[model samples]
Target: MRFSRILELGCILAGLFSGAAARPQDELVTENSSACKNPPKRVEWRQLSTTQRKQYLDAVLCLTKKNATSGITGAVNRFDDHQAVHSSQTPSIHWVGHFILWHRYFVATYEKALRTECGYTGGQPYWDWSLDAQPANLSSTKAYSTAIFDPTTGFGGNGDYMQPSVEQNPLNITGNTGGGCVKTGPFIPSAFTVNYPTPDCLRRDFIPWIINSFADPKLVANVLAQKDYTSFARAIENVPSFDQPNIHGSGHFGIGGVLGTIGSAAESPGDPLFYLHHANLDRILWTWQQKDLQTRLNQVGGPITPFDYSGKNVTLDFQINMGRLAGNATLKNLLNTTGGTLCYTY
Candidate 1:
């Protein structure tokens, strides 16, 4: 089937769950009482037992698969069915809205799965980044009631760059800074050289607060259940990005990029932080939705066109469904943010 036709069917499914009939794709969505809330109690990562961590990972993987499949299918179905009559003039207000809705559902679904499937009792936690700016000794990972990092036992080591400066000597001969160059001296290093290259080249010499700190685990559940846009926006704005780039060409490398990368190490995704980082990004987008209801309805600031890795442009009409890339999902089913039979609370 054509992409557009598939998306049309998906949209129909999404709308059916959302309690809305086929209508303009750009319509403003009415806030559902169950979709937003306050932050929840935080939980520390170190506090979690191995079993708990494994269960959380399992739940996250399942939820991601489910949403990705549904989202892609819906997108493809919508595109295939609406190709002929759809026009460029049609407003694209639903981009962010759809993004937000699906993401919230994504997080909530995982939280639910964790609770129901694996007997998870703790809530989702938030990592705070601002705390990393403090002085070394004074910086306590335990400052937040829900701190995820324990400074005393954290992995990055004690020193600022995790240890003494490698650039202390140029010609020490024991180490090289870069480009296969070695120097020997008790020399005051030039602008580019380092005596201890290993420490110098290390990323996360001092771990950031977000990775180390934790927020109330209930935050995800609360946000999903209430409509407090103020806190929601704050949380969204605070998500941190690492140094490495991903297939998407955005985000940080080691810390933030870790989860998103896929494939082997020689040419691997280049980071383990990718998935977790995107999950946080998705959370922020969801927060933006409740904060900016008007703009979402108007299709303001949506992507002009979807692009592939080679920079080729792809049309995003109602007919462009998700099934092509993500199996049986379609676009039509994703139009409405609420009204699905399986509703989730943060």
Candidate 2:
């Protein structure tokens, strides 16, 4: 599993160097008297009250029944558009300088879809993996608690041991821990279905060792301390050697099985947790930006093309398409949460 996963990551990284590559308030409510008015709050998953969690979950489930316009042949609901968007543009967006900006727009668009299509009122929430990455209490973090895994309020726990195994990649990391469908949680096949029309359940196989080892406080501190975008992006997306420690990939690797799809170059959005993971990622970047907001806001680098041998800066006008999920948006417009259509903070 180690070698295969590492090799898979190497390909992603090679495509990246390649490209390149935060937390804030519980409720990020910012009102600018000079420019814009009130901005909504994007809270933490743990911070959400039971009621808020239910509301959010209900709306998320509701998206499954809503139709999609992304043009992916088998798409079933609005949620499918998101998955389709991620799948279609995965190559250009991932491991590129546009990874952050493109995903920022993608996440924000999903939030907008929730509100517009499902009548959801609250802003999107993020998961803070660092809180659970502590050494002493790593085994019992809230990330694996009933609060997060309960069938009623949580997304559900790992897949049942009897479920079919995930197809092994070429390197043969031998799929994740659990292979069967998710038997517990609101996402059980009997209770809910994914918009992308998968026959399997929402499986998860939490790899405690990954989080305990790679996602430690020290690693988080190292990533946070990076001075420039290049080193910072490379550190987080650490390719070349998948064995190298990286805080960004920790969450994805920590939750293996179907949930591990986040590690897939594409098709990651199929997992509902993708947004939360990316939201937290955005928060980290936002925190880094806060250290030098004036300069960081305008800072951009990395390769224009995934396979570029020569390092080149990503342009502001880089185009990203989302089909009917949302209109095409440029990397520049997606850069600032405060400027352009984006108004909320982490």
Give candidate 1 misplaced runs (Cα > 4 Å).
1-116, 121-146, 149-276, 294-301, 304-342
User: Would you list the C-alpha lDDT of every candidate in the order shown?
Assistant: 0.28, 0.64
User: What's the lDDT of the predicted structure labeled candidate 2?
Assistant: 0.64
Alpha carbon lDDT at 133, candidate 2: 70
Which structure among the candidates has the greatest TM-score? 2
lDDT of 2 by residue, 1-346 (tens): 3323433433443332222111122113222223323555788888899999999888888888877776665567788778765665555665567777777778888988887789888888888777767556645444566365667786777765433334443433323455445677677778665544344455566666566555677776777798977556655666623356577667666675333444454445766887887888887777887898776766766676653527776766665655555555556555568663566677
lDDT by residue (249-298, candidate 1, tens digit) is 12222122121111111111111122233345454444445566554323
Judging by lDDT against the true structure, name the best candidate.
2
